[model samples]
Structures are given as C-alpha cells and as structure tokens.
Target: MAMAVAAGCGGGSDSGDGDTVKIGLLASLSGTYEAVGTEQRKGFELYLDTHDNKLGGQKVELSVGDEGDGPPTAVPAATKLVKKDKVDVLTGIVANGSYKAVLPLVEQAKIPLVSSNGRPEVKNVDRLWHTAFLSDEPGAAIAEHVKEEVDGPVYAIGPDYQGGYDELRGFTETFKKAGGKLANPDGKTKWTPFPKTTNFMPYFADIAKSGAKAVYCFYAGKAAIDFAKQYAQSDVADLPLYTAFVTEGSVLPAQGKAAKGIYSVLNYSADLDNEANRKFVADWSAKHDTPPTTYAMASYDAASVLDKAIAEASKGGKEVTPDTINKAIDGLGKIESPRGSWEFGKTHSPVQKWYLRQVRPDGKQLANVMVQDLATLGD
Candidate 1:
C-alpha cells in the first residue's frame, strides 16, 4: 500500500560511477494475500533502512508492485518496474500465485530477481530465482521429522493451489516413505477455493470422518491461525498435529491455546539459541513494533546475499549485470544464516536444515519450543 521511491543516480559511485541499481519489490500489496505483502515489504524496508539505503555504495532504489490486483494488473506493474523504472534487480512476488504470474517479464529481460521469502518452485524460470526457499528440498524436511512419531489416520489439508499441492505432496510422500499411510485416499489432496470459505467446519467434518490420528497442513499468515483454531475445535481433537511452515512470531499469537500440541517443521524457530539467531531475534524485536515472521527473517537473508554479491562484484571490477550477480549468488556457496549454515543447492535454492518445533503457551504467550536439532532432504 506504501510506495517509497528513490533515485540513486546522484549517489557517490563505488561500483564505478554509481549507476543507481534499482531493485523491484513485487508482491500482493493489496488483495487476499496483502498481509504477507505488508510483512515482506516491512522486512525488505528494514534491511534498507539498516544499511542506510545503500548496497555496494550504489543507492538502492526499491519499486514495489501490487501483484494481487490480478495478473493483468501485475503485468503493467512488472513493465513499469522493469522498463519504466529501469530496475537492475527484482526482489519480490509475495505469494506463489503472484510469483508464477510475473515470471515471464523478468525471465525475458534476463533480470536477477530475488524473493522476500519461500517462493514456490514454479516461480522460477531460469533467470528468475529466489534464495529463500527450495521446493523439493522442503518436502523432505516436512516428512523427515513428522514421520518419526506419527502414523495412522494422517490427514492432510491445504488450499487447491500449487503451493498447497506441493506441501501436501512433500508431507504425504515422506509420510508414506516413513511407513505411514494416508488415512484418506491419495487423490484427496485438493482442498478447494480459499478466501471464500471462512468456516472450516465442513472441511473438519470430512477430516474427522477420515479417522486420522495426525493432521498436517501448509497455510500462511492469518489463514494459518484460522486453521489452527479449526483444528483445535475439530471433533478429532485427540489427534497430534504436524505441519510445515507454521508457528511463527506472527501466527503463534493468534493461534493461542489452539496450537498447544501442534508441531511444525521449519527453517527458523524463534527460540533458537544460536548466536546468529539470538542476535537477529534481539535486534529485530528492538527495531520493529511487531515480531518478525519466518518470511521476515528470510527476507533479511536475501537482502544480505544480494548486497554481498553486489559488493563482491564491485570489488572485482565487474559490471553489475544479472548474469554477474547470479554468478556471485551461485558462488556464495555456504552462508551463516539466522537459521543456521545454509548453501545454495543445484536447484538454485537454499539447502538448509529444518527444525522441528512445538507450540506451548509460555506465561500466556505461545512460544515455539525448538525440539529437533535439524532435518533436511535434497541436494
């Protein structure tokens, strides 16, 4: 909803005469996914403000697009960011749906666009990439820990989108591999149109009839907490819960007691003790009014990687082209992220360990309990 614009043309040039390297932040600034976009934008802006809006001595100009207004609307915003604004890099496309809709423009222009968070695999089409997530990689993490102690009547639920399908597939594939059977048919993956069906009782009714001992799902932002409440109030209240990409600072507060026994497989758990995470969490809490989400943490890392690449490239006297930037990213190899040590995989996604977490009401505040040390799946 907020557009902050800057022209880096007059800034001092450390990267040779400082051609203002413009970066585009495309996301659903307004729509069903606006909550995610606002958080992502805040995270990106926080990094810029921390760095004084400079990357490699080149003024970083951010042009944000509202991708949720629909694909037709997104195309024009993409054009303005790419052609009119003349940005050097693209950094966001909030949800998996918007990312998928906007790829062609970035790919055609051969621009290196990073993401603010875990973008779906379908979002990538060669030059268009995200450092924050690995689609095939996360499948194993979700399956790895959930498979350990859960089995019998394992029900899966998610929206009928690619992201939903992917999460369901990742959890189910790993569950079955771990000797767990899908309480419902393998074909019952589709959940239906989202944002329209606010009441999840009917869905719960179906899952209850299926007789699942455990339930796993992938829902982000407000929808995640919505499902958590529904899951808690479901007739199958006795079932243990296993879900990936849940239990964050943002979602946990809304989830309240409904999330007491729910387990999550994620890249970052707020209670992590590592020095990097401790510092990140502390610094973030001090800086922002709201607690940072998993996406916010990943967005910070993405900015760090991009800024590192630009600085390294400038030091080597290389022009800041998309190809050169991507090469630097590919060569970044291993990084000490807030989550832990992560490296770029063959699929151009981050290969990192997933943490197993449990939600517990700590003194009237639900906090994530870091349980398993780590779990990972792909190359």
Candidate 2:
C-alpha cells in the first residue's frame, strides 16, 4: 500500500550558499497513500512558490521521502533523510502507520516530525509532533450531531488500527457521553485489518448480520470508495452510513453516487463557506489536477507552518535545528488557515476546529460539503 525510499542525509536545500535552509518532506509519494501524497507534494510546492522559498532571507530545500505502503518503507526512508541526507526538519505523512513506524527513528536521531495525518495517540509518542488534528476521532467532532439526529442503534466498522480506533472511539465516546450508545462501543469494532484483504465481501456480509441500524466508519484511500460501493450493493446500504475522515475529496469522487447522502466528520470541506476557504479551493484546484480535500488542506497547513517557522527562525539564526524551527512554527500562532484558525499543541498536534461533512453530487462530480463545525475533539 505504501513504498519507501531510504535516503541518506547529505545536504540541506540551501547548502549554506546564500541563506537557504534544508528540510525533509516525508510522505507516501508512492504505494497506498499515493493519492494523498501527490496532492500534499503539490501543496507543499505551492507553499514554497507562494512564499518565494526565501523565508527570512534563507532558501528552504525539501528532501522528499516516500513512506511506501506503511512503516517498513517509512522507517528506512526517514533514516535516510536524517542520517544520510542531513535534513533539519522532517514533516508530512499521509498514513498513520508510517507515522508510527518512523517516529522512533526520528526521536532517536532527535529530528522533528510534523505530521499531516491525525493519529491522536501520536501525541503520546516522542518526536512525533502533530501539526494536523487527530481527525480519526469521530465522536469529538460529530458525535453530538449523530446522537441528536441519528436516533437508534448504531453499528461501527472501522480500520481496526490506531487511526481507525481513534475515530471510532471519538464517535462512540462522544455519543455515549451525550447519553447514547453505539451497538458495541466496548466490543471490537467491525472492520477489516488494512492488510487482511483485497476484497470486502466477507466484511459486507458480516455487516449485514450485525443488527445495526446505522453504521459509522473511518476508512480512507481505496478502502473508503470500496466500502461505500460494497455497502450500496449489500444489505448495509439499506441503513444510513456515517463515517469520519472517509467521505472527502479523493474518496468521495471515487465513490460516485454510491456515496451520496452519507455523513462524515472532518476538519475541512471543499465547499466550506468563507473567503479564505473559497480562495483556497479556487487556488488549489487551479494549481492541481484533482479536487481539493481536507488532506490537501491540512498537508498544506503543515508546509505553511514550516515556511512560517523557517522565516522566523532565520530572524536571528543560521543553521536551522528541528527544535528551534518547531518553536518558530508553534509561535507563528494563528496564520490564516484555509479551514479558518489553527493552533499547534505542545505535542505537535493541533487544537483546531472540525466539521461534519456529507457527500453530495454537483451534477456528475462528487464533493464533501460542510454540515457542521466541530471544535477540537479534546478535553
């Protein structure tokens, strides 16, 4: 699902020639998260171009690494960037597994990793800073809306991993905290392990027997499109579908009308109503070949944070260290996020607003439209 490129740190983008800083851009440029990676890469490049790459009179070089499929690729790739390439800051990851895999390597090397994926537990890990919100938490964003509007027994089918669980936990926990219960919040969530299958027949069959009235899920990439298409072909589609971090730009377009009317919790939607949002959507689409997604937006933010940080860090500094650079990023405080406001956590995660979005078709094209704004899923 992911590919890896083991890089050896050699030089920064600047090479100290004329005031340029060298940093690493780690993401699944190939394999599973490729769809996400391509978009993020474009967004990152856009930031560099928009900022003119000379932040605070220094040039920023991005050493790109591909976190292919999962951690196996991500870990070694990160080693290359840190040990071989000699980059100062490392950031961007489309998959949570890659984050889990390369985190220790970055920590061991004392390099900083600012992530694009929202894996909440990452906050507990060392060196793995969260630039993006822990989007996998479903309840934190839309649980209240689900309980108030989705009245009845709710079933869940998640990815069965930290990211999946984080989203399910948020949905079920938030709903339960508001006096509602899913079919089995305490039970194993009904989901397929990401590596367990290429086909989803058995899973759909299992969903048919779960006795659930409505089902909530948080699978992304190909899995999301497949799940929605399969549900449409099975008894499960007869029930409403609710998911978080799934029904968005890349996945929704692929699902076609099979994804129509499904509910999801997210941080940004291509259809968010605001000047910044409108400009972002227009600029992103104009610049890229694909529709805009929350992944693109958050990844763009991650890159923007780095640009701002580098700009500030160079104010009185020369060689950019990850810690000093990260501090600069955090201190930049509230820059104009396309999604509105964004704040960094001490853990490198974000304290930001989330949203409830739904899949809808504008003519033949599919899009994720905002249904609600869910403020940070934390206490």
Q: What lDDT tens digits, residue by residue, belong to model 1 across residues 1-379?
A: 3334443432111234456666777776776566666767777777777777876555676778777744766778888888776667788666665566777777777778787665676524455556567543455576656666665557777776766676777777867788777777564554856766567778888878887777877777667877888878889777887776656656677777898888887787777778877777777888775556667777777777777877766665555666777666766777787788787666666777787788876665777777876576445
Give candidate 2 regions above 4 Å deviation: 1-18, 122-128, 184-186, 316-319
Q: Locate the minimum summed-lDDT window of 10 residues in model 1.
A: 6-15
Please list the C-alpha lDDT of all candidates, in the order they appear: 0.69, 0.68
- The number of the candidate with the highest TM-score is 1
User: Which number leads on lDDT?
Assistant: 1
lDDT of 2 by residue, 1-379 (tens): 1222222121232243433455677877777567777766776666666665544445555678888888778888888887776777777877767777777777776766777766656445444656567755545677777777766767777776767767777777777788866675455567677755457777767767766678777777777778788888886777888877566657666877888888887777777777877777787777776667767777777777776776676665445656667567657767578877767656556667778777776666767767777666533
Question: All candidates' TM-scores?
Answer: 0.89, 0.88
Assess candidate 1 and give its TM-score to the true structure.
Answer: 0.89
Candidate 2 TM-score versus the reference: 0.88
RMSD (CA, angstroms), candidate 1? 3.3
Clashes of 2: 25
Name the regions of candidate 1 deviating beyond 4 angstroms: 1-18, 69-73, 122-126, 136-139, 185-187, 316-318
Once model 2 is optimally superposed onto the true structure by TM-score, how far is the C-alpha of residue 51 displaced, in angstroms? 2.2
